[model samples]
Target: MRSLVLVGHGSHLNGDSAGAVYYYAELVRQQGIFAEVIEGYWKEEPSLRQVLKTSASTEVTVIPMFISEGYFTETVIPRELGLGHQGPVPEGGIARVIGGRTVRYTLPYGVHPKMQDVILARAREVLPDLDRPEVGRDTTLVVLGHGTTRNENSNKVIERNAAALRERGIFAEVHALYLDEDPKVGTWPERVGAKNVVIVPFFASEGWHTQETIPAELGLTGTATLFTDTPSGPQTVYYTKPVGTHPMIAEVILQLAAEASQARGGDLDRTHAESWRLLTRLAHGGLRVGEVLISPYSGLLELRHMLDEGRPTTDLLTYVTPEGLRDRVRQDDAGEYRPVRTFRTLPRGWRAVVDEADLRRALHYIYPAVVEETRAYTCHSLRATPWPTTARRQTGIYAKVQKASSAQVEAVAQKVCAACLRTRLWAAEPLGQTFFDGVPGGIPCAEACTYLVAAVRDELSAEKSPEKQDQAKLEQA
Candidate 1:
């Protein structure tokens, strides 16, 4: 027999959290898709671990009813169910043999393309009188999610869904607001700028956040239509039940289960593949630079020169091992020099030696605007300090850059570039730059100059591109 387990992040404070989980479990059970359809939770009864232990089926599928891939779905759920390491269940699928039973894990349902249909259906329920064509012109749809400071990954799917809805022009405007993050629920009146506002909670169930906190924050007496005054004018705000409570969600769960069962063993391995792929044509052919490879065993960073195919040279071929950088050197075939394969341990640093050409290529590849703007800037000005380190330290820099006015972005860019110069990260020669004389005391670990260029470029890219913003939201979520 096969079993299906619907796992939810149950609430300890209220019974609402697990309501939809149990509802869907029973709904699927009635379809007779599996011998048993059970519901499990992190905080409530029939805990994940307990349910898995007592299941009678030899095979089981655990589908997380989450809006995005985050801590709970990636860690707690997998650990409790004994599904591989306590981290992201592979993207393709996850099947593990544990305690004589096979468990297949599927990705969160929120990312599925069909989910937009469900969201649209939920919003339409609140605006029954509004025609399909008039929906976009008259109503503003707001997707309210329980954003978290702990894991930005929690809100990716919600933001993606919101972006998709906006692109479709199905509403006057589509805005994604968070309970714990930015675009606060209280400011919806002015932020939405629409007389008719429809809010749909992007939660798996009607928990405390959806049922109590959201209502209080929005100044709602109940789920019924309420009139509120905003900076613009008076507006009508309509709230609906959580998206997960919709009956159509049962079909989504079954679809996810079917997908996992089909991809069971073969593609699951491919799902755990690396996120970044460095193609040979791009690295060696187009870029004409060294190839960056990862060590299979230790996952260490290795830089191999394209010119020296067989022979390793100290020129640029180096690997960052656990201890330090291993600079590979090629010796003569004769007895005069050391053996052909020899490596010397270099001091631990970001790069063995910064390559100007490589840095330019990387910057242009990652952020073309950065390269175009800084064309006159010499490599010396750009090479002094670590750009990657500085960029990482400045969290949310992309949003800061994006939100800034046209004048503000330029002014801020000048200030940032000047600061980099003062810190010795940027050069002062070409522009008669007399910003700062010496480097700052607490300079971070120096990485390849190209990496720093790439980092800054990425921020600029994010600022200029809306699609990049959506992608960033997905990543951050």
Candidate 2:
């Protein structure tokens, strides 16, 4: 059997990075397409060297889940794997191929042609009816992704996809956005110049960039579909989920793995079989903790699986940083040099000590009744007008609601007004006492106070749309 290895730019702090890798790998396995599939991460446990060793087979293929093919894929990965680029290695050389298996590496996931399918799928999902003759001609589509400051290729990927979609006549207009660099996300509304804007993330998965940064910047307050009241008083703003987890992504992974294996002179079909077994083993956490902490994203999943399998609770510290979180030990076994960003993890831990008290004190300013009132005002803003599609689409009433939504665009305003309030409460529940430290008036509290209000609003709107429609019909009749 051949083998395929899926490599990701993993994060020690965030579980989502690894989660994306595992999600795609599992998708490949479920199709019964590969003989063996294994995953190795840069930050988490089971270093690349270790995974490459354990996954040794006659022919091995490595697929990088990175969005761009510049630095990491071209330089770092090859340097680490000892696959020399300058020339064919003599018998004894620094860059040597081992495992008696031909090694092949494929293109990064973002560069895949099939990615266009996801962009289309997201547009269709958000604007299913928008494509009708009446809606299709008037709508403007924004294929937004997190462009990078470090890499030019990242922005190109989004731009290429948007251009391809426009060439196909899918949307009246299409544009790209970035978290950093020029033509930033903040300026997208003006650039598109359309009446309705649908923002679709060109990201691999839903993490901070997709979940927090993008929405916060756009002033989005609902689900994947962000809408505002129109000047005539109708709803507008559609935000789609990150394109990574869609069912179609599994096919892309398999296709890339096969391509990589073929480049190394291996049987693509057999390579998959080898990959399956390896992936299953990795899922079982076969590798030990070693000296470093694995990714909190996949490592957390693996840890949970290990716990389920009766593995001892090793002295693990899940590191939290702005970059992401990690399931780690104190020793620097990871051989990683990037600095970790700080974040909160569990009950009364580092985040609790640092931000919990402050958070609780803030919650008092956000008592349940106060939060509920804020939701009322914000929800009113949502239903108050038709969403503006572009900079020109802004009208008197729509502008009024947009301004109102922007004003209350905080945890308190959003939670009270949208459905995510419940989840926001749960996510923030751990820090309750900390926030209540010096509060008076009998420890005032509420059920929802911490999630991005706009996201929760969208979730609630989607869930209740059908019911809402029926109510509207009844009133009209």
Candidate 3:
């Protein structure tokens, strides 16, 4: 079976860092090119170490969703994937045989030749006039990157991109600026020597750096193009969104994965046929996902939306495909979007009948990463992160959650997690066994999800509010 793994440097404090990775994973999955497509992270749930399941696929292609080849792409991913304590990685990436499986590691998409096109595409969006040679001749393009002292090559990747841009001759002057290293983002005025300047972040996603740091340093306003008075003269600066936001980047990542897959004798069509038996065999035992009961029926899996005991399936909606099932789960009864899939808000009255081959894939669409989560739980490889441990890592909006009392944690979990179908094995301390004891083969939650964190943060915020303090004062009076 041909399997593709998209790996990213996920941030615990901020969820937006790995946003692009998830976006592309879903995009690739919908294309139906690979039998299995999943995501791995360095700091978030479904981490790199635990993401790789013992699936039927002997060949797995891992593509780094990083802009540059740095400490993470080089040292971190290889170690976690058991690709050996390595030397230097090739530009195209390397293929290694580990424990009866072949792992193909591709270079990060940022350094690919196609990145020049992505950067230019983003630039064109900011400055439409750049298509004209005169505008290009007058413009200065700034490729902003986050440089690090730990790895000199992190900044070097951005520098090489700048050099390539200069050779392309679209922009009169192209400069590479870093947040950490020399030729920093703060020195844009002195560093750049053009009246028309365009700054584009070379990093992935609009995270803390792109949203908070870069704007503050560059003195950017709400408008896309702004004028600033400098020592040289009045300058017009056009700020484009980061390269990671560009949709064209999807093409680059897919091409890299395809090259590695095809080179290693991967058959996309037959991979599905080979993996169907093994993957479906895992789901042979009945399990409940959300309010749905999945059981084997006549060589096919039947997913029925659960009703009250002694109730019939008379009013339920019937679906024959995974897409229909996913659509049903994406919204509530009121038609509002439910980002958390396993919540009690799963729209009821829907049934789906799919073959063994489509069962795992269909379940994945309705409940993201449940197949791997179940496998991890089954093998006892699941690392259940405690709620407090996860709360402590949040140094942003959810930081106050770390100070929550035991009772507060329990109240929040009962309100939020009790409504979720996923068994909170990680939250067993505050919420006892009786909380999720009745759930049937419940989805195993490894860590505190983003929704739970938001809920805890809200409760904590309300606890310390001045309104609550005033109410306490009135009671005392």
User: Between the candidate structures 1 and 2, which one is better when assessed by TM-score?
Assistant: 2
Tens-digit lDDT track of model 2 for 72-141: 7666566545566432222111223554445666667777878988778887887788667667666677
Better of 1 and 2 by lDDT: 1
User: Runs in model 3 with CA error above 4 Å?
Assistant: 11-17, 30-32, 54-56, 262-292, 295-357, 365-477
Tens digits of per-residue lDDT, candidate 3, 68-104, equal: 8776787778877778845557866788886456789
All candidates: CA RMSD (Å): 23.1, 22.4, 7.0
lDDT of each: 0.56, 0.50, 0.73
* Candidate 1, 1-477: lDDT as tens digits: 677888887643444555677678768987987766666776553455445543445677889888788777887688767676666666666888765568888888876767888888887787786556755587898888888887777778888899998899878899998888887667787677777888999887766787788888777876566574477577788898888778889888888888887633322111111101222223332332212221112222233333333343443434333112211221222312111010111112123222322332222222222221222122222333333333332333232322334454344445443333112333222343321111221121122222233334555666679897788799999
TM-score of 1: 0.52
What's the true lDDT of residue 368 in model 1?
Answer: 20
Kindly report the root-mean-square deviation of model 1 from the true structure over all alpha carbons.
23.1
List pairs with backbone clashes in candidate 1. 136-171, 136-172, 152-476, 152-477, 153-477, 154-477, 381-426, 381-427, 385-425, 388-452
